[model samples]
Target chain A: MDSSPPYLSILGVFALLSVLAVGGGAAVLPETKALTVTHFHWLADDEFRDIYGLGQLSPGPNMLMVIAIGYWVAGYPGAALAFFGFFLPSSFICFGASRLWNRFEGSQWRLAIQRGMAPIVVGLMAAGTVSVARVAIEGWITAALALAVFGILLARKINPAYLVAVGGVVGYFFLV
Target chain B: MSEAAPAPTAPAAPAGPVPLREIFLTFLLIGATSFGGGVVAYLRNSLVRAKKWLDEDQFLEALEISQTLPGLNATNMSVIVGDRLRGPWGSVAAFLGMTLPGAAMMTALGVMYALHKDHAVVSSVLVGVGAAAVGLLASVTIQVGRKQLEHVLDLSIVAATVLMISVFHISMPIVLLVLGPIAVFIYRPHPKRIHLRRRHHGHDIKPAD
Candidate 1:
């Protein structure tokens, strides 16, 4: 690790990501993959996928995987910067908008904004799914696993954490 | 052009002052305990069902704001609910409590991952984990977009947004700038639609029990 990492760049990237994350962390997956793996070379595609899985396995928001990217790039400071940078701007926006939210409660424009953004957010999320799929799906086994998981999830209300664990076991036995 | 009077009253919560410690601990429990990625349900169970910090209407209202904003639903709800409870400090406490557990876990995982990433066992398991995540994300997207996908215009917009990002590789700002306004304009209010707000409000807010 560099003695003094480029904290500013890390901050700048995550801040931009925070604002652009309109539909949450999943919506920003492609962008995060693009910036971290392709643009910055901070991590490889496999590394990104692994870290994302780690995030999924943990409690709280899965987006917290961002700290891993920062840690790989520049140690503890990088980790802190990534966490604050990713969460702060969006939190402030949520805070301000929420405080002022009721002021426009009954306004048609507010309704319009919500209505208009709904589809767009959905679109963004679909794109995120595709992006992750691009990196994670390698062969028939992986593809089958993904499909099985999707089928199971849509069919039932089981906890996803269990599926994720089962996946690791399957991988340990078969993929290896 | 304005219609109903906009009340500037503070958020409609119970009159009793909530301690910041309680705010932090409540969110802390949710953060530490909620697994499988959907924090919204856990939030509703706690805030509305368990604690009654917010009534059903207030909870739904907060959820709408959280979804429409540019952040994770978990964190945004925490901030909005916390602010409603105890101002900025409450927001701080809630945000911290909601994130601390996950952050610590991710940090420890990161260190372990860094050390053993290249090991065949770790890599193989992660491969499966990542693949499973794709399914998880797809399920979430489909569920969230099920309503939007039914409408023709919304479907088109969804298609366009997906195309722009996945195929065209357009950045997010450009995607939002191009699609956001167009979609909003498409849904712009008609002047002749009087009392539409009331209809929308009823449709959105569930009856308070």
Candidate 2:
């Protein structure tokens, strides 16, 4: 059990995902789930959902929870590696591409790319929804909780932290 | 705050770059305080309304670049806006300040979860948290994708993408390879697409025009 191999795998998987995450973290959720659960078996489905929940609970980018997967596989070093693997590559891309993009100030192709990618991004997001649902919606109780939160968010401008808290309370009483 | 709000047409000064510390602190504040999600709104308030570091057009331009990139808009915006304020070092400082707090927090939480892998109560609460996340992601996708989803052709493209990935279980790269170009071509700069582009005119995605 020399642990470095899995750690490297974690870095490799997330670094690859960092670039391919075209519409941000949500767009890559299904692929992320696939690589982590289906391919690498690094996380169980439920575990993956729970870790994603941790990211959502935090204040910054929701994808930061990838740290949990790394930590689970290795240790503190793994957490550090996950952060590097996930953020660095994409940050570099944005840095370089933004510089290049400015040079194409009037390029019509830019608009076309934006228009073309938008719908496909939406579709990827829809699939992302399903990926979370598979792990989150275990039974009628969880499903109802999810639906309630969805309806509340759509209907009001309330902060979601409160909704997530409400969900925990509901689950504590009904689920456990 | 009023003093900080620059007019949209304010000229970019060739004066000394914004102090790197100021860029770091502003993003640090945003990273620490922005809650739940919708970091974009927090960013707008701080950068445009409060700090007056960037005008509305500049902020939106930075935002558009952020969204068009691959990572989370929060980090990407930090990079772009930070770079605008200073340069690569500014981007580095802002990135560190923005991500450090949340990264530290998640790391702690990850450690806690690992240590208590089978805790009955912990797992129970996590189940609910996960469910709530699903709801949040759903609303977020709908909100962001609303513009792209309204047109029939666009809607079909969206649906086809969902089916290809979710139903067919096709890997993402292949789907992007085959469909990404097709979708772009369908919306290319032909006369019909030009008309459609006009209909979608004034959208920030085509800001330079």
> Which of the numbered candidates is closest to the native, going by highest lDDT?
1
Q: Which DockQ-derived CAPRI band holds candidate 2?
A: medium
Off by over 4 Å in 2: A1-4, B1-15, B198-209
How well is each residue in B1-209 modelled by candidate 1, as lDDT tens digits? 35266635444455478899989999999999988787877887888877678877788888889878888999999999999899999999999999999999999999999899899999899999989999999998888787444469889999999999999999888999999999989878977643543455524432223
Distance from true location, Cα of B174 in model 2, Å: 1.2
TM-score of each: 0.92, 0.93
TM-score of 2: 0.93
Q: A1-176, model 2: which lDDT tens digit per residue?
A: 45455777878988988988888888999999989898888889888988988887777888888888889878888788888999999999999998888887757788888888999998999899988998899999899888888888888887788898777777677775
> Which residue window of length 10 is worst by lDDT in model 2 chain B?
B200-209
Kindly report the TM-score of the first chain in candidate 2.
0.95
Give the per-prediction TM-score of chain B: 0.85, 0.86
